[model samples]
Target: MFLAATTAGDRVRANPGGQAFCPSCMADLIPKCGEIKVWHWAHRTDDCDPWSEPESQWHIDWKTRFGLQNCEVVMGPHRADVVARDGLVIELQHSHISPEEIAERQRFYRRMIWVVDAGEFREHVDLRLASIRTDPYRQQPTTYRSFRWRWPRPTHARFTSPLFWDFGDGTMLNVRKIHPETPCGGWGYLWTKPQFVRRFAVHVDELGDALEDGATA
Candidate 1:
């Protein structure tokens, strides 16, 4: 967790030896201001949220983008990475997670959004995108649903917010507009299908605007 609550119920970033408490568990938190990594708060004992993942520089960078508005927010019994004032819970995921876990989180945070780092899957995504570009379905309006990728499952159709895929580059791909399709002969299998559009590709800095637009829509 990056932000902890002071005794006065104010949110604060931990400094070495500073007194802080977890907003969810109310356990003592220690400030880790080491020279090696970004300054953050950690539980003195065990963390209440077992699902919490280790943070990376990429995760830190994304959280910093929210400034003070993005804090470790307590949702239900767990703490979310960032909960904006607009009631959007932003989860910055950099590692591979099980589909069950993803589903669980989505169910738990009803209005949550995901920002997945595709740095490791760049080559795969590139190939998929290239293939999508030349796909015959790309030219037809009705067949647009056939353009898809593998990672962002089309089965997660219930997710209201767009899943943002960040390749650690300047651009991001919005996977929310994609629709899932099952082949007629296949036995109830969801396939990756996306609607290819130049506008769906956006700059990293424009994420805030995108979220606002998505919220309104």
Candidate 2:
């Protein structure tokens, strides 16, 4: 999903100026290696392969350790040189890339970029971070709990990633709350007492009839 400018097939091959390609992922990595210069162009894997000293040109040290795991600062799909996903891009406040290239990346992708507050990264690099409002697509498993309206109010709404909705307003609420109980106050009472089912049936029947009447006109 790379923008046309960052397309893989158009890469510069073995430029002495310091750019190399990862054979497996085709990400353009700058030639950076410290003690073991021979492994300068090794592909980045989850396992420690080669220790490439953080290049000054990278603008930021993207490698990070969280909890018991280390953040794998490797390349993403065939487009960007560096990548990290929290379902979001992790980037420094200052990295050098063209503005056009950045916009194109946003068109069909998500990327971690180096960002700088004020100074330019490369000469004549008219790169500025553009502010685009994007609703984050949550991609993790969701947990749910049953609520009882008889006493305590809802502490939090339980929703899976896809279940939530963005209500065009500044506030985004779930379009629908998927519970067997049609949102109503009688839910708790009826579930508590079997006799209430009789009354509930009549109520639902009347409500259905009202809806049917409304549909006619």
Candidate 3:
């Protein structure tokens, strides 16, 4: 967790010699400031939530973007990675996650957005995004198949929210209005069918105006 509660009930980041406790479990948290990894608090015992994944530099960097104040929000029985001031939960997913897990998180945090690392799929995403940017009018809509099992897909239409797929190189694809159609049978079933999905894409750099408009809504 990025933010831990001090004895005085104040939220603090991990620092040398600082003592903290998990906001959810209330267990003693040890501040790990090793040079190899990002500084963060760890449970002194084996009481930490199993669902919490090990934090990577990418995850830490993204969390820092929102600042510590908006990081590690305790909601019900789970702690969200980051919660915006407007009550939007921003979940940054770096590693592979199960579809079931994705559905659960969306169900738990109804008002949320997912920032997923495209990782290996980054190249495909970038190419498609470039095509959209180069000739949006001509391209209209482009579809790309997801061969990687870890890649997230639109499970349901009702869970419609902007999903920012980060390429980890400062490029991001904002996808919305996702509709997952019937799967293509035969050998094509081996991979996720691009034709079965319909989504609108926009570059993150071009999202400033849209985001500003959304803030008002």
Candidate 4:
């Protein structure tokens, strides 16, 4: 968890020797400022959200891009990775997840999407050019690609929400449609990093403004 609540109800990042509480469970959190991993708050026991995973730089980067205010939001008994201003929950998943867990989260957070780190599974998946068409509304060319999942994990076929697979490149494969029969495959668009971020993050406009300010003074 990147953000914790101080006694004064202010959200703060974990620092060395900092004392805070989990915003979701209100459990005492210990600040972990180690060198190997991204600094974050941890619960003494594994009593908090059962679905919570170890923090990773990939998770941190995506959360930071969405801004801390909108990240680590409490929804029911679980803390969503990133909840956009428009009430969309963007779950950043890097570690392996079970199909049951995926279905559970989908049921819990009805209005949610997934941004998965494809580094782990992209190797088992092959993509090839399918077709390209221009959108009449946006007047932008849309490229479509077909994917073949060789020996795919069961979880790959269990996505109820939108799954954006990040291949560590600047582009993401947004699975627009899926064919769940044996030897699962799908067709989706390759969205650039900015396109994905801009569509989901409304506060990105504020970030853009801050970057556009000519004066660093």
Count of clashing residue pairs in every prediction: 1, 8, 0, 0
Lowest lDDT block of 10, candidate 4:
208-217
Question: Largest TM-score belongs to which candidate?
Answer: 4
Q: Write the per-residue lDDT of candidate 3 for residues 1-217, one digit (tens) a residue.
A: 6678988879998899988889988888999889988888888776465557667777776665555666777887788887764677888787667777877888888988777776666543313222213223124343332322223244423334556666555445454434345341111011111111112112333334323322121
For model 1, the superposed segments whose C-alpha errors exceed 4 Å read 127-161, 176-217
What is the per-residue lDDT of model 4 for residues 21-112, given as tens digits with 9 covering 90 to 100?
99888889999999998998998888488888888988887787777788888888899998885898998898889988999999999999
lDDT of each: 0.58, 0.27, 0.58, 0.80
Q: What local lDDT does model 2 show for residue 132?
A: 30
* Model 2, span 5-37: residue lDDT tens: 124434222233455454435555554335533
RMSD of 2: 23.1
TM-score between candidate 3 and the true structure: 0.65
lDDT (tens digit, per residue) of candidate 1 on 13-120:
768778988888888888888888778788767678977876567776666555544556687788777765456787878777676778888889888777778677
Weakest ten-residue segment in model 1 by summed lDDT: 184-193
Model 3: per-residue Cα lDDT at residue 2: 65
Q: Rank the candidates by TM-score, best first.
A: 4, 3, 1, 2
Q: For model 2, state the Cα shift of residue 42 in Å.
A: 6.3
Q: What is the Å distance of residue 40 in model 1 from its true position?
A: 2.0
For candidate 4, the lDDT comes to 0.80
Extract clashing residue pairs from model 2: 92-115, 93-115, 93-116, 94-114, 94-115, 94-116, 95-114, 95-115
**lDDT: which candidate is best?**
4
Residue 173, model 1: lDDT of: 54
